[model samples]
Target: MKVEYKKASLGDIQVMQELVDPEVESGVILERSSDEMATNIRSYILAYVDGKLAGFCALHIHTASLAEIRSLIVDETHRGNKIGANLIYKCVDEAKTLGLQKLLSLTYRQSFFENLGFVEIQKESLPEHKIWADCIKCKHFPICNEVSLIKNL
Candidate 1:
């Protein structure tokens, strides 16, 4: 099946919300309001298959040399079709275009990221700015089990 990828727009917020809420509820990702997604819409990339929203991902830049792939979620119905990997490739290409030196992600799906060429790293090794800006606000901060994975762009 062919998948189309594009930047997330305001019109796609409702679908993105539907696709993301479950993960947030289950604690796979931090909670975000629909308004927040709408506001940060430029940071997102969406995947579509047969005109249906398949997944959403965000390339969140924190500094000159660092960026994180955030909120990457592929719908259950579309998981095995490589939609998630395509989303990551888009993020990586965007990161390269933006002159970013690295990409990082805090994810529970280590094998998924590992398959995409991301290497496991110490979460604390990341700059304090990234930790302060997002992780500190996360409900599972101190107890978070997500692995920090990185790929030098």
Candidate 2:
């Protein structure tokens, strides 16, 4: 399958919901509202295979030197196709473009991130306290099950 990566626009909001809702239902990812997706649409990069919605990921800057990889998901049927890895690399490319020194991922899939050159780290090692803003909306909060990893760009 030929997967094309593109920046998401506001019109892609419904597709974003369709892609993320399943992960949320499975308790693998935090739920996102269409409104929130629309508002942050530019932060997202989408993957399309044969012109169909394959998956997406986002890059969110928290500071001059740091950014987070957010909302990474590929269709269940598309698993093992490397779409997620491509999306993450896309974020890393963006991070490098913006002169970010580090990219962080809070993920349950540690080996996946580790295989992509990320190293495990205590979440507290991150300097920004504002990164916790998203925690307020997450059921996991202080007890987040996700592992924190950083890739130096």
In model 2, what are the clashing residue pairs, if there are any? none
- How many pairs collide in each candidate, listed in order? 0, 0
TM-score of each: 0.94, 0.94
Candidates' lDDT values, in order?
0.90, 0.87
Which 10-residue window in model 1 sums to the lowest lDDT? 130-139
Which candidate should be chosen as best, given lDDT against the real structure?
1
lDDT for each residue of candidate 1 in 47-87, tens digit (9 for 90 to 100): 98889999989998888898999999999999888889999
Q: Which stretches of candidate 2 lie over 4 Å from their true place?
A: none
- In model 1, residue pairs whose N, Cα or C atoms come closer than 3 Å (at least 3 residues apart or on different chains), thus clashing, are none
- Candidate 1 ranges beyond 4 A from true positions: none
**Number of backbone clashes in candidate 1:** 0
